[model samples]
Target chain A: MKCYYHPDREAVAVCSVCGKPLCAECAQEYKGKVYCKECLAKVKEEEEVAASKSNVSKGDASKSGASEGVVPKSAVSEHTETSSTESKAKKEVPYKGASTAKVVFTSIVVALVIIGLILLSTMGISGVLTPLSLVTSKSSSVESVTAIPYEGERSITVSLDANNCMLNVKELENAIDDKVVKENTEGAKLAVLTSVNTASRMSYKNGTLTVKATGLKKNAVVNLYLTIRIKEVSLESDVKNASFSISLPDIPISAKLSLTNGGISLSNCTVDRINGTIMNGSVTIKNSGVTGIYLKGMNSQISFSDNKFLGNVSLNLLNGTLDVKGNKHIASFYEKGVNSVINCDFSKTEPPMSATFKNITTEVTINVGKQPAVISAPYADVKADSYFTVNGSNYTTPNYSKQYSCLDISVLPAGETAIPLGSITLLGGD
Target chain B: MSDIDARYMLGSILLSLGIVYILSNVTANFSPFWGFIGIFLIFEGSYYTVKYVFRQHKDITNPLVTLFLGIAVLIFTFHIVIPTFTMLVAGFSIAVGAALLLSGFVFKISRKEVLSGLILIGFGFLIATPAVFNISEKFYRYLHIYGVGALLILLGLVLMIPRNKKSVKKDEGGKSDEVH
Candidate 1:
């Protein structure tokens, strides 16, 4: 039988040596160790023989007095083992090949199962385990909710624990994410563990998650863990005209929480609602999509993972890290003090916007997307090639990474503002 | 070498972008990378339209082709024409979106119509933003190009990638068995 570890009930313990599985009775204790009975007996015999032979030297064993020297009591008795003694000796050393064979096999099987589980978890299982602590309503109410496809809309959770969890909503859908919802949109309480003895509930309905508590102890902190389906799976149609919109509801947090999604968008124009005004929260959005978009979350690090834009677009970065992977522009906006990271990895896409990252403090990396990237003045520390190239105008920034082609100081326009765009860059890949 | 769940993976991206593109226009949530991503998809669609459908690689409607317009405008007018172009583009996008959406409704009347109809109608309805915005080009052209156009381009991109192309493949992160 295999061993299973549990503190409360009777557990079949595994042997430290030979690693044989043993039940409470069949297992034996040796040197404060646990092992199956057969191994224990054999070990005991070896221990006794070694102890008795310890005193005798190898050289002395060949001498005369060594004959009667270390005869074990059982061995001595077994000399005249005409019948009974012989039988007893054989019984004491019961063969253990069968037991050892079983053990090795079991260990291999157990180890394989463990490894498989770990791999499954590592390969995008965060979307599964991240939702384990969700508090679903005892009654189903809202039925029609859309999420990334093959993943049915998850039932609403009234509450969730943020302490320790491994529930990912995405994975669970592919692996045992089964919960139901009612057709009618009913507000459900989402529970969060406040203190050691207190519990708080966050209400959710109509795609919104809100605090249910009446009052807070001023700066008291509470986390609302969510295994939210940030986006729904969409199937492509040959029709090529299928379109829909996803709106992210306003979520306020006490501290800050990270937001990551593959492809998703919101109906609201301002993402600041997500970064709670009074709650001191920063909202971050990372997604892959094709539609035009407008996102503004206060004090959030916003990034575009991998996206395809079909028409025009406007990108406004208020106060956050804006990273663009592949894009064609309709237009773009920026403010100083915020950082911009651009990665142009388009297979073949172009944007129709006058993409500009102005009033930036940190940095902007441009993997240019067909159209020239414009960084207007008042953007204190722009960084690129020797010459910032926008409409062939020579521009420069304070910090520039001295690598890559097609960037020089001569690209900046002459007599613009105070600092020459040329003074900001390292010419000739310097 | 040969890896990836080519199907569901692309589908996931397409759909995710679909949502992102759709929302970025209306929502205030800001994600810099996602904006570029939406732009990327829009170009991808433009490329597809030019190379595969219309064979007009440098046409005005093509996203890549429009980059030329953006560049020309930015050079001459200091980012003026590009902004207005995007605003106008948004209007045209709405019309195309409307045509797609109208097809969806039109196809509904016929029992044996293919998905082409629904896609058209959906596109139109989804593109109804210009009507939703109820604003003039003056507003849409200058300030709202990136925000509004980003969203529309994203929407168009999401619609471009075939939804049915999602593929599922085995994991390929590589594995090492340890004897615990």
Candidate 2:
């Protein structure tokens, strides 16, 4: 039979309420009864109207009984029970027809909202729908070099600000003979090599070489080959191929470096002091010597290997790893942060190195040298080797004496009322 | 408000307070963003709990799911055991997917729920297994960003399409006459 709603379509079912021949699109099943859309709406409206009339009558009867002072609590209970049952039944109606349409509309809206949120979070407010350009092989390469002559300056200060690029700072093997510098001139040089997609600036003034590079947007598509190569080493690939190589004269200079979403490598450099702040990157300092060191990092992997600090070393980390390996020596070391893993091998370190750790939920491993060490960790769960004598909140090596040069180690809570949820492992070495 | 709703609200308030106190004491730097998310989950969990307890909802699945998600978020904020954010998300996804799949089999839910459960399980595995097995990151990113959204759109479209209904007389062995 032809359908009621669409005459050209074949009828699939007959509405139980009105006996209308219904197409699939116009038929709805409710309480095991197939009804046409119109019949279903009409029946529901009629039932609601009847229910309202019955409720009105009940209200009138209750009022009349209350006025006559003969109302019964049992009747009120029964009335409430029946109303609740009706409400429950009404709530059991599954989504059908118009309600299903509403769900689809809502889903589309939600999908759009989710897409918008992702764009906003990854791409920021500007350039929401810009085409992805990070991965394109057609982008041109841009290179810039800046050289600063050493004009009787005893100490040079190097400052760098970079984003989404690899930064390397190394002592010039030939301080004056580098091709980037003049033959007779002896100075530092800053060379920035990057893609056209990124923006970089370099300036040298008053004994400081300042270099800045901004990376591409976070959500930009990356080249598959480059991404795979970088991702294997756990590096961000949105910058395509960008790097800043700074060659400094082998002198006692100081450095101040800041990075966002990039890696920093400082090797074979001598500095009076070094201060660095990195967000979302890895830091590697190998075979470097400095008088003092201060670093703050978030979501970064910081490592110091074969480095010597004549002064103090202060590190603050959040949500990352810190590894101090090889022959590392510091006059004093202080670390403060949360949710990080720290591994320090001070077996080859010089004596009289005072180290203090204040953190929360950070796993710490320290290997003590031949020097006698007195370790105090009140907040941390300390696991010490058998070579140490255990006192209350203190672990002391058998060779600990008041007159000897000792390593003073202390682990305390980062803040008041903060519970330390991490463990500390102390390994004794000869 | 009904008695059950009032009690649920009170319970939610107390639970939020407890979470705040614990988070403040446990984490060195307590992030407000994750804190708000945890509280939001707690409220949702309490709402579903009330629905299940008062017989307003027919099944315990929703309450259990919400409760697990809420607790997991709270624990993530603490940042004690879980090492990285990616691992936390992967673990949570895998756990929720497993829960959904189990509930689908045990409760005999609708076909849509079953499909959704299977999809979530697949996504969870896709996200978690890649790091261990050295899967390509570009492929993972594409799948994570576009594939999930496309699936959601497809699901919506599928739900919008109308299905053919069976003849009542044939299905019920000539029950149309009785109804008439």
Candidate 3:
């Protein structure tokens, strides 16, 4: 038989709906049944029409039954069954897998977005807040030089109060010489040179010259020089990095210095009394003489080299150290502290100089050279060299006598909590 | 899957991406990609647990395991001092492992959960003494990277796995018929 759709080809099978012979090319297979293409299309259309009719009839019947208050049970059941079947078919469909190319593309996009956000948060915030001028600013300094005349004053007090600054003060004879004095008809000209990033005020009133500088730029240096024809000078500074050099006339002058968070250097001065207090810095005194000296320090180092003290000298320390070197002539020295250290070489010191130490957890080392010194540490852990005679807590030299001119050293307890005293080393030069 | 599950999965992905974006902007030290993913997983697992509590589902073991795994990954991604980080990891691991073990043995949850609980307990002990094992920072970094990467790939594969919709429909129909 000739094929229904393809007449030139031989018939291979019969259409399931129409019973027409069909070739393979003109046939369609569905659910184990083969049909001609035209028959298959017609059959699908007819099924769709029948499904529409059934749905229409069900909807009409339900509406009529609802209006009459008597719904058909079979209609409801059929409707539910159809919906359930449809939902099951929907649920049964497998989800397609996402392609690798798409995932890679998404990841790249996400990474780019993250990087952009990071950059914006880090750099954009700063860019928005900082001023344009401040971004390219440079450091520059300002200098101001002034000369104040010194009148015929026997004693002058110089006071400086500064913050975050370096101060240099010097006393020179030739600074206010005849030429400078004659040049300025007012008084002895005091040369003051100040270099800082901020403004500083200097006023000379009565017998006191006060220099005050606050809110200076970080790491600023201020220099001040004074040359006066005065006998006594009392210099007091509550500044940082202060260096003072004073020369004594025939009559010595007294110096009073105070600092915080800075160092103090005092050289070549003869004073009746030297009083200094420092916190968190060091104090260096060289080539100076004082009738009486008092120094109090905390977290500081106080060193005295080539200094003569004729009267009583007192040192109070807390977490600090004291070093005395090079021919110190201290007639009487008293030190009291906690967690401090005292290293005194009485080798070049004059005889009859006495030192009393009242310390807690303080290390004391004394070198008495050819000076018959009587060392006494009642509660201290004493470690004496062989040159000294250790008699219990008292260490004494062979030639030591109470009546003779000898060095007397004593180490006593500092506070009530001084359960165990610090170490004490006594050395005698044979 | 139901519409709710699809919505939750999409929400998890979006929330994780958002967290990554925010963390990238907030810090420059390390990427928080894996940490955010773990957080999303924890949130998703909590949602599942809530649904189960409301009698919307029958299973509980899968959600519990996912919650524990999320916590583990979150702890692993933390960048802190070695001692503190290790202690946190060990403490969390031991706590979760103990809880899982109790549920699996006493409450009779599932064999898979019991095995995972034991494994977590072992891991906790191992992590407790990092000095004994000499675990270096480099090793930890590599582990974090690769572990998180593998988790991501696994998540993708699971999401991409084809569901036999016909079998699922048949099962549901059978259940409904039995109910009827």
What's the TM-score of chain A alone for every prediction? Answer: 0.27, 0.38, 0.43
> Which window of ten consecutive residues has the lowest lDDT sum in model 2 chain A?
A225-234
lDDT, candidate 1, A72-142, per-residue tens: 55643443342343345447764455533343344334333432343244224222223222222222222
Using lDDT as the measure, the top candidate is 3
Clashing residue pairs in candidate 3 are A92-B165, A150-A188
Q: Which stretches in model 1 have alpha-carbon errors above 4 Å?
A: A1-93, A96-98, A101-127, A130-246, A252-262, A269-388, A392-430, B1-180
| Residues B97-140 of candidate 1: C-alpha lDDT, one tens digit per residue | 44333333342243323244355345444444443343222234
Residue A205, candidate 1: C-alpha displacement in angstroms: 12
True lDDT of residue B168, candidate 2: 46
Candidate 1 positional error at A189, Å: 12
Off by over 4 Å in 3: A1-228, A240-253, A378-430, B1-180
* Model 3 per-residue lDDT tens digits across residues A100-190: 2333344334434533443454334322111110010111211111233333432222222332232332223232344433433345333
- List pairs with backbone clashes in candidate 2: none
